[model samples]
Target: MIATSEISPIATLSMQISAVLVWLGLVFLTSNILHRFKQDPELVRKVVHIGTGNVLLIAWWLHFPTWLCVSAGVTFSAIALASHYISVLPMLNDVGRKTYGIFYYALSITILVALLWDRFPEYAVIGVMVMSWGDGMAALIGKRFGKHTFVHMGNKRSLEGSFAMFVTSAIVMVIILVLANGFRFRDLGVVIPVAAIAAILEAFSPGGTDNISVPLSSAFLSYLLESTL
Candidate 1:
């Protein structure tokens, strides 16, 4: 039944048209972004390989059970993020730079799958925020202004980038929560704490692929807090 109450012609058409335009832009602009790191073929391969799977996985998260979906998504991403240490840990060269893209794809897809399968749409948005906005900012800032170095768990990373990631990720999560609640920011009870925990993970995680870990870890931490408090 095509209910008149559910249909807004202008709004629907505008959103559809805008979505199409955004898709087209991404299709073409991806090449330019790839070109920036064209000299690094291995990195490109890893990025493309991971991205291929990740994007598809994320798209499938809209139909799952809420809590379980997010929990599974977090678990999957945590595995991917923690996997490298147990495997042949590589150097954080351009190779490492590209590694993040793959990690992002993997974790993003995991969460997306969880969202779709578990009907946990809330976590899906959270996952994407950590991946796209948080991860992206970390790398960009790390490359541009990262000078202060720190070693943790046998990994070399920067404090400046850590701060950037923490602030950016927290802001994104908070903004998402605010907007999700119709700008009623006061209703953000546990989400605010969860976002804060996520920021801390963003600042301290040595995975180099914090994108992979952030969403999954945040989700799990959310579950933990919800259970205890």
Candidate 2:
């Protein structure tokens, strides 16, 4: 971990701002390219979404300060909110509903970085990874191979999608926990329950709300499990 004392405040702020700008630019460019090619907008959106979340792994790996991560999250959220209002990024807003998911997604990222970055950074990464890989795969698989469906809160969900979410989440959490906390029977205890909860939340969450629900739930469960152990 990089000591807070090692990084000057100005340097941290500049780095954070630059990273956010680059990320936003990439999102804008990628969206336009996908549109130009007449690609599957939903798939492209989820790919970008998952990629955006996973990029935090670079920050975590580099031992960025929590404040820097929080700043990036805030900056990203502001831009997303502006885009939502003005339709500046049509690809991101190409979803079925008019919602504040981008805002909520940014909020969740900020919360995880602020709360878990210092003490349990691995958990933070795990939470976001589940949101990224698990959620992303579920949507992709659900759309392509979702024949058996059920309705939840006026939204259609598929058993295949939920299974995808659960399996992916479980695999991610288990691997991360094993690497970070060591492979033990106790770790399995934590992994199973957390993955199940995350999958359920994703299944029930309507529209873009899963952006908030999945990571938050996974982070909370991971924290609780770690605290007890």
Top candidate on TM-score is: 2
Which segments of model 1 are wrong by more than 4 Å? 1-28, 33-104, 116-119, 187-192, 203-209, 220-229
Measured on C-alpha atoms, candidate 1 has an lDDT of 0.52
Relative to the true structure, how large is the alpha-carbon lDDT of every model? Answer: 0.52, 0.81
TM-score of each: 0.56, 0.86
RMSD of each: 8.1, 2.9
Q: How close to the true structure is residue 33 of candidate 2, measured as C-alpha lDDT?
A: 84
**lDDT at position 108, candidate 2:** 85
Which stretches of candidate 2 lie above 4 Å from their native place?
1-31
Q: For model 2, how does the per-residue alpha-carbon lDDT over 99-126 read when each residue is reduced to its tens digit?
A: 7777778788888998989988888888
Candidate 1: how many backbone clashes? 11
RMSD of 1: 8.1
Cα deviation at 99, candidate 2, in Å, is 1.5
